[model samples]
Target chain A: MSCIIERLAIVGVGLIGGSFARALRQAGAVRHVVGIGRSRANLEHALSQGIVDEISFNATEGVAGAQLVFISIPVCSISAMVGAIAPSLAPGCIVTDGGSVKAEIVRECEKLIPEGCHFVGGHPIAGTENSGASASFATLYQGKRCILTPTERTDREAYETVARLWRVAGANVCSMDPERHDRILAEISHLPHAVAYALVHAVGTADAEGENVLSYSAGGFRDFTRIASSDPVMWRDIALMNRRALLASIDGFSASLAELRRRIDSGDSPGLAEFFTIAKQFRDGIL
Target chain B: MSCIIERLAIVGVGLIGGSFARALRQAGAVRHVVGIGRSRANLEHALSQGIVDEISFNATEGVAGAQLVFISIPVCSISAMVGAIAPSLAPGCIVTDGGSVKAEIVRECEKLIPEGCHFVGGHPIAGTENSGASASFATLYQGKRCILTPTERTDREAYETVARLWRVAGANVCSMDPERHDRILAEISHLPHAVAYALVHAVGTADAEGENVLSYSAGGFRDFTRIASSDPVMWRDIALMNRRALLASIDGFSASLAELRRRIDSGDSPGLAEFFTIAKQFRDGIL
Candidate 1:
């Protein structure tokens, strides 16, 4: 397990970035780590926890002499962060991201990086409701999917270098177009998040026969709405960044729900049974 | 833990009924158990497993010498089963049910029971995806809630007797009016089932950018839709029996989803954050 990377810069060393740093370090993949963030307290906390060897408030200063830069910031802020650090990065440096939405962020970042330096869009689709460097662990990315979205401009060597690092950290890396990644993720991830939030809101506000039904809910209701406990700011940003796909998904979901409502409303026994059976079969297939 | 009942009749020796027989026997509270069901093979399985002391195909014949009769059948079938067994039950027989919807079943069963006998509506709010007597367990109701719906006409001693049986099964027993039980369950249980089925249907049928996005889903989506794998016939019966309350809950859920859709469609960052924030807060409060 010799060192695969000489020096790495981790921008916004929160949960995702911090976990990346720790996982890479445990695998002996990276030699040096520089953590960057807006929160001085969080950066210092990361430094104290040995998650980062060094801490920097300035993006340009932190990325200096780094062979690879990994940005794990908010989706809306990624391109700007890349632009700020692009001038300081050495020639032939590879820059990758861990944003959930890829197409928009990838397009914005590809143009921001200077010539001779490479930008590869990536999404390590693993997370929890908890945030900050304190919540990170060395095995958070283990056995998870880390999708690399490589465009026409992406450097083959740089892409392999990024994928290799994720693989060493116990992630299954696969490559796809950034546009395809966003579309698929909308249905599987973002849309479920929106539906979970809406369900929680509905149950929280309504009372059945003057009883607060939400409070009396047991394992099934609780398990179904578990994703509603996710971080609000992160989810809000995701909903907006993946707006078109998410909105389309919402509409699609509404139509499906309406179909179910029709069956129940008309008391269509055969129709209802068929609907549930189809759903169960599909779910069982995936499982 | 001495024998609390000399003989017990279990009509429909399926998951609920079979589990009740197993749990009571393990607690040493019932000396004789007679399992009655349409599926002779399943009753034989229950008998072979030592879950029941005897097996009978006819409900009337099964309850001949039993002092307590427990019917764990579909909601629509409970009253008819009661009517069939009422004439055979001895005097002072305490009959109860394990139907999800109580109000309708209780009313129907109460009128069918003979004067000397009593009928109580009970719902064991616990189960798994698997069905039949083979899935029976001695601790299926451990640490779970078993809600009993008792009306003014319900016999006081008979209600306590039913409560004691569930208590011995390791259930937390509570009483509520049948109407209130249906209303609360519509929000907490029935509505969630409908939503889960609709979500599964939506993902199963749609392809994102010509890709079946469902095959790529992981833990969150699977856990959220676990209830969708439930028995279709049981859910269909529940939907029809609790139509009015379930329909109202569905409307409330649609409104909640529509509000969220508006927030995302308009790109209202603060509004989206507020909605998510409220949802997270509510979910947190319950947890």
Candidate 2:
């Protein structure tokens, strides 16, 4: 598993990319790691913090001669970054990502990548409330799931390389079709963000004429607020890119919430208890 | 602060009572602490672990010489415990509680307390997911808020004694009327539990009909399930007893959720972003 990716280039030096760089270096998975992002201060910060071997403010310079390239920017800006690095990527370079949704990136890569190069859509289901390079750490991906979406035409060698890189980063990689990946994540990841954001919205603007006690919400609402505190641009892009699946999740959640309200109103105590118990057991089963 | 309560009796020696006992002892506010509960095993366990100076199986016998009695049972059974202990309470004894909702318990005390005793309603707004006496620690209430509701007829001396006890228990005590207390708590505490229970209910029940991937709910859904994992009987009683305020909170939450869905469906990106930003700022202010 040593140096699975000979020289890995991260195209965005944010939390995910910086964390990937740190993890790869700490795990000794690559000979060299280079980071590219928009800010000079962040690049300098990442370099001083040993997040990368070299810092490239330009996308093409960073991707040059790299065996594996990880596009770890906001989902909305991924297309422009891919187009910028398309001409400079090595002939057999394996390109992947750390985006929340997979389909849009996979589709964008299809039209942008050269015929000989490889493209495997990936999303490591891990992170924290904090963002940016300084917040990154080597153990960020430990024991987390990383999902890869590879088409039939995608090179098997390229997929294996991507999977192994994630493994070294302490991830368990699973392969799925792009469509299924989006749908599955819509239920598990995207929908939760949307619902959390919506709950915060409701609590904040609720009773505008009143004291608006969202300030005092400490228990569950605090957690909802923390989840909603994620990078706004990143989340907006995820919601818009995975629109269909995310909408369907909202519908599912709405139905369930409405049913719960009905049960409470009807004083169906046993039904409520059963509902809570089943959910508790389901959560207990998860890591 | 030394031995303000010379002999303190704590009924239902679970997480709350056990923590209270530990905090009182650590602060040197009670010279002797006695544990009481229906479960003999719990009483024996509490005594063995040194959580209390002594243990008593009979609720009446536990409060015999004690100056202060804390009813820490589940909300539904607090009234019955009050009735059972009224005959045995020493003259001028101060009775308070650790229930979530305060109105019903206050009403119950007014109906059942002995003529010479005083009852003040209380709620300590602090806890964790874990329960039982073993989970208790002396610092459980540090920097947390505690609400005290005293009726017009409540003895000033009794009310002050209860407030002083919570202060020694490492809580910031605030006084409020019983009805107002219920309304405020419904929004801050009870509604979050209902929403969490409902969210989990939706996801768990869906798995019965389909390939419900509650397992993959890694990010925001984790928070909902964590809160939903609270004891079912406790939450049920809170929801039933604080019905009106909880119902209002539910309605408020639904209105906000509906507005979010409408904005998303209409492609109102700006509106959605504005909602998200405002919510984020509001939450940031609170945290």
TM-score of chain A of 1: 0.96
Q: What would the per-residue lDDT of candidate 1 be over residues A1-287, giving only the tens digit for each residue?
A: 99988999999898899999999998889999999999889999999999999999999999999999999987878888998888999999999999989999999989899999999999987887778999899998898889999999999999999999999988999889988888888888898899999988988888533677876688888888999998888889889999998888888889999999999999899999999999999888888
| C-alpha DockQ for predicted model 2 | 0.55
In candidate 1, which residue ranges exceed 4 Å CA deviation? A207-209
User: What is candidate 1's CA lDDT for residue B221?
Assistant: 85
Candidate 2: stretches off by over 4 Å: A207-212, A219-221, B209-212, B219-221
Q: Model 1: number of clashes? A: 0
lDDT of 1 at B97: 92
lDDT (Cα) of model 2 = 0.81
Which docking band does candidate 2 fall into?
medium
lDDT scores of the candidates, listed in order: 0.90, 0.81
Residue A76, model 2: lDDT of: 73
User: Candidate 2's residue-wise lDDT over B104-219, tens digit each?
Assistant: 89998878889989898999988876777887889988988898998887889999989888999899998888887888778777877777667666666655656656766775
- In candidate 2 chain B, what residue range of length 10 has the lowest lDDT sum? B203-212
